[model samples]
Target chain A: MVTEKIIKVHAPATVANMVCGFDILGFAVKEPYDEMWIRLTEQPGITIINKDDYQLPAEPEKNVAGAALLAMLEELTQPVGFELTIRKHIKPGSGVGSSAASSAGAVVAANTLLNGVFSKEDLVRFAMNGEKLASGVKHADNIAPCIYGGVTLIRSIHPLDIVALTAPPLFVTIVHPQIEVRTADARSILKKQVYLKDAIKQWGNIAGLVSGLLQSDYALIGRSLEDVLIEPVRSILIPGFNTVKQKSREAGALGGGISGSGPSIFMLSKDEATAIAVEKVMQDEYQQLGLDHHTYVTTIHSSGVEIIKA
Target chain B: MVTEKIIKVHAPATVANMVCGFDILGFAVKEPYDEMWIRLTEQPGITIINKDDYQLPAEPEKNVAGAALLAMLEELTQPVGFELTIRKHIKPGSGVGSSAASSAGAVVAANTLLNGVFSKEDLVRFAMNGEKLASGVKHADNIAPCIYGGVTLIRSIHPLDIVALTAPPLFVTIVHPQIEVRTADARSILKKQVYLKDAIKQWGNIAGLVSGLLQSDYALIGRSLEDVLIEPVRSILIPGFNTVKQKSREAGALGGGISGSGPSIFMLSKDEATAIAVEKVMQDEYQQLGLDHHTYVTTIHSSGVEIIKA
Candidate 1:
């Protein structure tokens, strides 16, 4: 019998810039995950394989998974190579951290093959390369939660400080309206400057949100889940966004908003029933708009890239 | 002995905007309290007595405490009159919540006499009137902490939401440089608009600060005690502000910034020894600059207005 060095992992999906915590807060979800397998290769270079219909690049540099692996391999003192296979269940451009799952998945699998030598922060650092490849910038909002699991706060990026925050149990309902919102367009549309008053309100909301999560105050959480800056503008890009969100809250969601750059909307509820009910609200709203959409009812993922077969 | 029908309360000083949380976060301190006595009277109007040489106005409309009392009085269905005596230990224009102590003291005292008829939120609403009288704008950063005690986040003003936050054991050191930076001048110097990037950073810090305080993570709190918006502009108004803050950090204080608008600065330390050490640094820095200053070493006051003598 041959002793084969292979690692298979499940990397969860994530929601970034959660409501008032734009560019800072994010959390991993239980469903809509990506599966990846890594094998130690005698071939001194990386090999990429795509099993999904996304028809993603097999070239190491162009691929999200490949790009993330390349960054981690560079940090190793001893040379190592990996053969990567990706099966992405999370649809690309779904506004639910599709790129992050691919990026975080590859690095997490490669790290296991390397005997878990890299820290979660190191893995996040390598994974951000994939985000850069996907979005033309290195952002950890999605990558951090996808790698660290649970709810994560990207306190600072310059030195890379990640604060893993504990939140009360929550059910997440997501609806993707099947609209293409280029990340660049979302970035460009935001005003270069905002009123100081608005900024203060935004931070005040951020503070309240953090406090609510820490204290497990659901009402406070609902009150703080407001975005005065990005949501007002980017929400215009997603049809039925306001209706979906308002109706979801009416259906019993604590509160939620656009996931990442969006076209997808997410709502948080205290129970699975409410989450499912919120999901129905999303499905109905987009259905009435005659827009193609997808919805998921899930919970906050506890662990980031779960190891399957090692 | 006949009942005196008098209420004497001690209102502690507070530090508003506690670094990156401008217009949102604040905390009460134990020392530098204002002693006030509110007497039930049948005069059917308000009477003001000043025990200090600050020469504050005797007119109810012109006084901070009086203004706050007047606001609360309007809400009462039946007519109520009071004779208010104020002996303020917190200096006016020192930026250490001097006006807040007066306002909160009067309101808390009034509420106790009313048998706690109003909630903390109601008292905050009334106290904001004092803030308006003092600074021409109703702000609760100071009033919230001065009334609720410990740390408070004024989540919103229009709707009036106050979230009392629990913080880890900590010491507060304050320095008043005896120079006056008018509230109007301090506020007018701030930019009406801030860069979106900077605003993101500010909110990120606020999130981290709130998380740190709730989680009892001192290092996170220290890291988050940074203000890129208000501090840069307001610190210029306080002589030796930079040196006092920098030297205090070097002496092992966690981190801190301008207490409120300016002139008075506050530092947080893990213990009393460090707080006193930070105080000495404050004193030395101001002394070297040949500026007379006052310093206090205190802790967070868990109860807002302590009834010294009922």
Candidate 2:
């Protein structure tokens, strides 16, 4: 017998950094999410009906949502069929945790349809597996924040220890200049070995960011939220990235950097005015470049992944 | 005519790592410091005056304080003869910012007696020069904290930018296992290049420490306070280093590592009882090692340097 159930989920866009945190930290946003609709079918196969028709993968093993739902089912004792319809709102390869949103939303929808068999943590693990299948690396710094919400720090990758940091009352402004830069190409250009001095400088910034966050010393946070090591190397791949960052800082941003493996830039501010100011600067820069872009001014999210409407 | 004036000053002990802040960030201990005294002479020549005859450099040019003071005098129009008498309390190379104490104290004393020509910042700069003379490198992670009083993060060494971190209420337990490890030898033994994987792990820990300190997440702080890259190479120089760390952890330390370039190990705890517990464990381990050792159980010093009654 086919158990027909419709479940809807929203996965927020995320700024992968608040300055010093590169691949190891991120926070979720309030709008511009990837919504997914999931239902269980009697047919023992996986199929993705790409409602947005964004040339998304339909194969269960290949698609992010499909891969995650299949991974979750693989852990189940009984075989099941799933129909996942992904509505891609967060742009693909925009450095906005796109794959994370799809994976998170799918697993959440699938698990919800199955009467919530797997725990939230189990969902994160399962989503990570799907992420690995999609991105070829199992990094959860971005995914955890998208799924769990709040400012998240990934202490380790092998053991996958994720901690939700105490969220400061803040806003995040993100700009995705519609320039395409493949993640694979972006990863290839970075030098394998860095100077010891650069490494130490990066550590200092990390330390400053941590202390700033804890003390709510916004100025220190702004001062410390600099990426001397990774951003310099990675920003070269994104057009007008340096300008955006400079302009954003001028616009009264605490600080911002290339979001995730960019083509997108993110700005973090203490208030809505600063966030809006950052957004305007980024938008103005993008308009001058004649590149279409998307922007978000968000607060620090304290919640991760949850059922939206079922 | 000779003017004999007494000055009393205190420099705080500092924690090098706020969990993941190893080697890159440190803050001052507010109290329990090493004290020194300086006296001017009209004998028309520099004189040697070591109170305890602790085998430090007796020649004005060779002494750390003397070297720094001489350097400062060289920048001035007037060159004066003086005798430095140090009533040493903070043990040298104990990783409680000892060299920092001497370097900073010397400049403070010299600057004070020189009619207050140099500012506190100028003193810090001069002391760092002394540090460079001693360690063959000019990094102010330790010296700035000792001089400035609170938590200080050395962001850049070349264009030296020091950011003062607002540290929360914290307790510290420092144990100096009497085995002497020369800073020169400790530095010499470190390998030039570490594995990329290990470097990545180290960065994650740094990020964690920064976040842990910022949010005051004690558990996160403890978990992030690890050094897989530099510590392993440096720890080989100190006997029973690993044992003390493991035992201290078991005894409830939030976590700690080698104090500066050590024979000293420092741990942070949330409370006095926990710090005491960790200190006892460290002391017991040193006793078991059959080594004559000393341990200081104290708290995080919010103040850096102070002038006390002579």
Tell me, per candidate, how large a share of the native contacts it keeps.
Answer: 0.88, 0.59
Residue A235, candidate 1: Cα error in Å is 1.0
Question: For candidate 2, what TM-score does chain B get against the true chain B?
Answer: 0.89
lDDT of 2 by residue, A1-310 (tens): 9545688888877767555665677888886788788777789768898878579878888887777777788899988888888889888889888888988888878888888898777787888876787568777766788877877777787777787666568788888888887766776776676665566677677666766666677887788788876787788887788888888888888887888888888888999998999999988888898989888877777665556778
DockQ of each candidate, alpha-carbon based: 0.91, 0.48
Evaluate candidate 2 by giving its C-alpha RMSD to the native, one decimal. 3.9
Candidate 2 residue A181 Cα shift, in angstroms, is 2.1
How many clashing residue pairs are found in candidate 1? 0
In order, candidate lDDTs are 0.92, 0.75
lDDT of 1: 0.92
- Candidate no. 2 TM-score: 0.86
The lDDT, on a scale of 0 to 1, for candidate 2 is 0.75
| Model 1: residue B184 alpha-carbon error in angstroms | 1.0
